[model samples]
Target: MTPTAVDASIQRVARFGATERRLHTIHASAFVVMFLTGLVLYVPTLAQVFSNRPVVKGIHLVAAAAWLTALALVAVLGDRRALRRTRREIERFDADDLRWLRRRTPSPQGRLNAGQKVHAILQAALALLFTVSGTLLWLSERNTDLRLPGTIALHDWSMILAGVLVAGHVWIALSPDKLPALRGILRGTVPAGWAASHHPKWQAPPAGSAQRAPRAGPVRLVAAAVVVASGLLVTAAFTGLAFT
Candidate 1:
């Protein structure tokens, strides 16, 4: 191959940008805070060892709030083009992805593979569930009419599920083969060879070439509408429940 062709083939690719890196950092820090505080609050041994229930609970609540706020800010201020690209990558599961999942073929993925996409969606849903349930549990502290036991049950169960998922996520992220992906999130780029091997479908732009900013498409508009509608519906239902 010619020098130009080789240069094109081995060019470094942008994986995560500044905004994505910041968001991931915020989420990771919040998760660590919440998880540690939660363990202290939930575990009998840790509770005794900590011997400061209120402080632990306070820290957990603050972490939860921070996590939620970070997510809200990202939704409001993050680049829509980047978000759309990520969503499309995560949502698309072709035959290659399936074959890779089944171990029937080598990894033929784009920016995100099936496992990462599934994990991202599941974690997002779990975070939402945890937030709702935690809020209900908090409200139950002041309102006797609110079903405390049910809220507690929901919150506890959600936390347990989230904890398990987080453990798996950590295991995968820290694994030897996946460490480069973690580094990409931290540094906003990965080696061209690594990208080429693991994500064969990802086409890296030529070295030092600028990537064009994508415009908002119909799919993005529809997705935003759906999210807004869902948020409204959920808020209305919660308000009704609170009043009645």
Candidate 2:
């Protein structure tokens, strides 16, 4: 009674639920506003063209607030179970995930490949840094004591790193091979065949046929976590100097 290949190719599988899409939509929309406004604020040449610096600055602040608000709203109203599961998936990496990073041909070990997981981690960390540094910079304008040299550099560097990641993400999403994934995120479903080919580990299983996949050693994982945390702490300490 197994389905034929043709049947699988045309079958639609749920790739992302409604809550996920909504969160992504809000995040993306806010990011666009922030990035564009940030460009004007960061680039001297663009700032010259846009003479109304006050308005631009206001818009940039508003966008940053919206970004923070979006996360809060999602936390209060979004599917808690789904969000938790996604967080777990993005945080853990298995042997397949490690291989996925070095050899691109093989299917990722899960719904999110290793690279995607890494990108998600970086984005979250950078977003936190951006918020912290941006807030300090905004307040520093009024309270000279809050002014910190490292704060501005952290904010600007975060934006640059995030920009590069976003660019690569967009390029991959737009590529023909990856278009199905992009469409899945947008529409919440994808051809089962495509999912099978791209993420075999996540192929829609028959009812009551689910099982857990094996994971890799935790040494590297712990080391990576410590490295990221150390970097963040160093930057945080450097930025906090102005306040102290």
Candidate 3:
């Protein structure tokens, strides 16, 4: 069936719960802030515009902590069933997914296609690398005489890798075919037809039971606000330290 036809036959489906959506928002926001602040600190030309190294470093660290915390919280409290399903799909790619990757077949995917799964896996690994190298870098700052030989290089290279992966991720996400998935992230629902066409194996919730609206509970809002405020406070405090 054509994508449009498939979508037209299905009802609006809820793909993400409120907690999952909140975690995603927090993670994405923190990554953007970290990427920007890290870029400014790393590039000489960019650093010239914002010469407060301490403040920039502080922002980067705070963003990293927030992003890691969001990931941890999602792991602990997000949809367990969805997480398990995604993990299984990622671990064993279906034949159709491989064929799709090789351009030998045209078929809809399950909850996540092979490409998406691979991306998630790589990003997760990179996050770990960044965390370790970054911690070493921070410690080296306090004890220069005990600095590890390759700690700085590892951290620098990991940042470069992350930038490249994120660029590809953004490009793919913005492509026409992936727009529906992007909309699902923002709205927590996609037209049944679109879901069926893109993710054929995905089972929809029972009729009349789909959550068509995005949840913006007060607690979620407050938590997000606190994260942003904490990032700002970290930046200000470090900037003050630089002046002292």
RMSD (CA, Å), each prediction: 6.8, 10.2, 5.2
lDDT of candidate 1 over 1-244, digit per residue (tens): 0111233445456678666777788888888897788778778999999997776776677666656656655565557567677778888889888987788467678778878888888877877878887787766766867755677677777778888888898898999998888888887666677788888787754333423334546765666566666555544544444344
Using alpha carbons, what is the TM-score of model 3? 0.76
Best-to-worst ranking by TM-score? 2, 1, 3
- In candidate 2, clashing pairs total 0
What clash pairs does model 3 have?
A: 6-193, 7-193
Off by over 4 Å in 3: 1-10, 206-244
Ranking 1 against 3 by TM-score, winner: 1
lDDT of each: 0.71, 0.73, 0.70
TM-score, model 1 to reference: 0.77
Clashes of 3: 2
Off by over 4 Å in 1: 1-11, 206-244
What ordering of candidates by lDDT runs from best to worst?
A: 2, 1, 3
Q: Model 3, 1-244: lDDT tens per residue?
A: 2222223466577666555566668867887897798889889999999988777876787667667656655554455566666567678777888887888376667767778878878877877888888767765666787588987788778888888988998898899988877877776667777777877877755334533334446766676567667646644544444444
